[model samples]
Target: MTIYCDESGGLNAGAMTFAAVMLSPQVAADIHARFRSVTGLRGELKGSRISLVERAYLLELFDRAGGRAWVAMARRDTIGGKPGGAVPSDLSVYAALLNLAVGRWLPETGGVCTDVVIDDGRYDPVILGKVREEIQAGLGAWGRASLAESHRSDGVQIADVIANSLFNIAAGSPRAHRIQRIIEPMLASKAIRVAELKDFG
Candidate 1:
């Protein structure tokens, strides 16, 4: 499975949300092509920019296209590492939450190769390179991980919407009610699994 990842919310305040959506690259491209054809969106379909109806439509498209996702959030208060006025770096926090979000999809036994693609806008190339090694080591097999800009990855763009939709509610955005209403159907149907991380290990 190829898992596309993205995150929303500030690492320092409120709640931070991460999404890992599993789909093949070909399927991701086909879905986004439909999105562009229908929505007439010119470029870069970002979560924060899409309207409520558009967001719901895209999510439905995702679900119907056999996409599976895992989204997780952690409130600032619940996140660890506040002793001695120290806080976790953005990379550490992101990696931990990301690992928690996508880790469940990994098979217990090896042999299978899982590919991970994350939004690479945050960290530099050298550091981003490390993610592949860590994931492969953790997998103990032929696992691949890479980072790409959201504008370039259809699956990552989809993940951005998932993360942002939940973040709006988790962070108490004014659109919380509408976002909740939009996502409730999927939550009820279990198409997208949502988890809250109190202990981020």
Candidate 2:
């Protein structure tokens, strides 16, 4: 199995989300090609850049194509500390969420070798390495992980959609209701697992 991961929010006083989309490599490739052909999206399919309708269509395709996602969320009050004092870095919160999502999705025993692909955002190499270590540890030493630019990775783009959709739900955005309606099937079918982290301060 291959896991593609991305994050949304977490930069300031708002909800933060990390989402992982899992699928077999061949299936993922097929879906990516199909999605691009069907949607005719020329550039990177970023969640923020696409419309709600586009988002819905893309997510539905993921559901129909056997892609599964795990979303981990942390509200500002939970991971953010006192206003003036030492606050946890965004990378730390992101790492924690990654750990939670991967740990929940992968089985403890007899799990196949997994590869994790993350969006190469502004993450520092050292922090990313730590996150990789945490995820590998959770996957029992068989997991391999690497970073890629979202523009070049269709799987990571899917993860970006997952993270953004869940972030809207967690933050109670007006679009949450509609987005939830679209993703309800994924939740019902257990294709998506959600986690909300409490105060880590």
TM-score of 2: 0.88
Candidate 2 Cα errors over 4 Å, as ranges: 11-13, 82-87
| Alpha-carbon runs more than 4 Å astray in model 1 | 80-85, 108-111
Q: Write the per-residue lDDT of candidate 2 for residues 71-158, one digit (tens) a residue.
A: 9899876667777877777877887888787777777325678888877785877777777776666666777878888888878888
Provide C-alpha RMSD values for all models, in order.
2.2, 2.2
Candidate 1 residue-wise lDDT, 1-201, digit = tens: 688999998656588888988898999999899988999998898899999988988988898998888887877767745666555566777777788887867753245677888888877877877875676576665577778889999999999999999889988989999999988988888778887877643
| lDDT score, candidate 2, position 136 | 65
lDDT of each: 0.82, 0.81
Best by TM-score: 1
- lDDT: worst 10-residue window of model 1: 104-113
Instruction: List TM-score per model, in order.
Output: 0.90, 0.88
